[model samples]
Target: MKKIAVIYWTGTGNTEAMAHSVADGARTAGAEVAIQCVGDIAADTAAGFDALALGCPAMGAEVLEETEFEPFFAELEPQLGGKTVGLFGSYGWGDGQWMRDWKERTIAAGANLCGEPVMANEAPGVTELDECRALGEALTK
Candidate 1:
């Protein structure tokens, strides 16, 4: 079975909730899913997955969480070429620019995005979570 990693870092648990839904969707779609916090997993280990769903809430001027997620993502980015990746996050402010920039970065890294990145304003409501799930399912494809 395909092995997928649902990795994330969350300040307010918004992105964590999205990560669970992403993993659930992947499991439902018949893939083996490992859901983990960014601090708990190594970038190289996560990069070994058949597909990836990455989440981190927007922080400090609409950028990724600086301390943990950014460094982890930077380490993981080089391994993403030709990998299937899905991006999701929550933003309390700004116009979801973080997600857009993240998408561009992922593309520039040569990662094959599963679909549009999923974003929520504060906490993800039902729609955004469902979209996250769909993003997960797409990764399994």
Candidate 2:
């Protein structure tokens, strides 16, 4: 089975909810998955997974969590040369500009995105959850 990692950082459990949906989808698509907070993920552990799902809620002034998630991504970004990557997150306000910027950055890092980043305003609702699951299943292919 393809090994896929779901790495995320959540302040209020919204993004965590989405992460679970993603894992469920990946499992349905026959991918072995590892789900963890970015803090728990090893800095040098990118090579073992065929696909990666990164999550971080929008933080102050519409940016990724600078201290943890951003830095973790910065470390991982440098080496995503040929990885299948998916991005997801929750946002409190604004028009999902953070996910947009993040998607652009992912492209710049040489990763192939499964699709446009999946996002929800606060938590994954019924439709959002389905989309998140589809994102996970697509990562396997």
Candidate 3:
């Protein structure tokens, strides 16, 4: 079975909820899914997954969570060459510039994105959650 890692860091649990839905959809699509907080998984270990679904809510100035997620992502970025990746996050303000920048970074790293990156403003609504699930399923493919 394909193995997928759903790793996330959330300040308000919005991204965390999206992470779960991503994992659920991956599992339903017959992938072996492991979901964990960003702090719980090392970047090297997360990079070993067959596919990745990464989540982090937008922080100040519409950037990724600076402390944990950013460092982890930086470490993992070098290893993402030719890897399948999916991105998701929540933002309270600003356009989803974070997700856009993230997608560009992922592509520049040579990672194959599963689909369009998913983003929600504040808490994710049902539509956003479903889109997250679809993102997960796309990763499994």
Task: Supply every candidate's count of residue pairs whose N, Cα or C atoms clash at under 3 angstroms.
Answer: 0, 0, 0
TM-scores of all models?
Answer: 0.98, 0.97, 0.98
Cα lDDT tens digits, model 2, 15-69, are 9999999999999999999999988887579546899998899998889999889
RMSD of each: 0.6, 0.9, 0.6
- True-vs-predicted CA distance for residue 123, candidate 3, Å: 0.7
Ranking the candidates on lDDT from highest down gives 3, 1, 2
lDDT at 81 for candidate 2?
Answer: 79
**Model 1 residue 7 lDDT?**
93
Task: Give the per-residue lDDT of model 3 (tens digit) for 1-141.
Answer: 999999999988999999999998999999999999999999999999999999988887878899999999999999999999999999986898888888899999999999999999999999999999999999999
Model 3 vs truth, CA RMSD = 0.6
RMSD of 1: 0.6
lDDT of candidate 2 vs native? 0.90
**Window of ten residues with lowest summed lDDT in model 1:** 92-101
Q: Which candidate has the highest lDDT of all?
A: 3
Give the whole-model CA lDDT for all candidates, comma-separated: 0.93, 0.90, 0.94
Q: Which regions of candidate 2 deviate over 4 angstroms?
A: none
Better of 2 and 3 by lDDT: 3
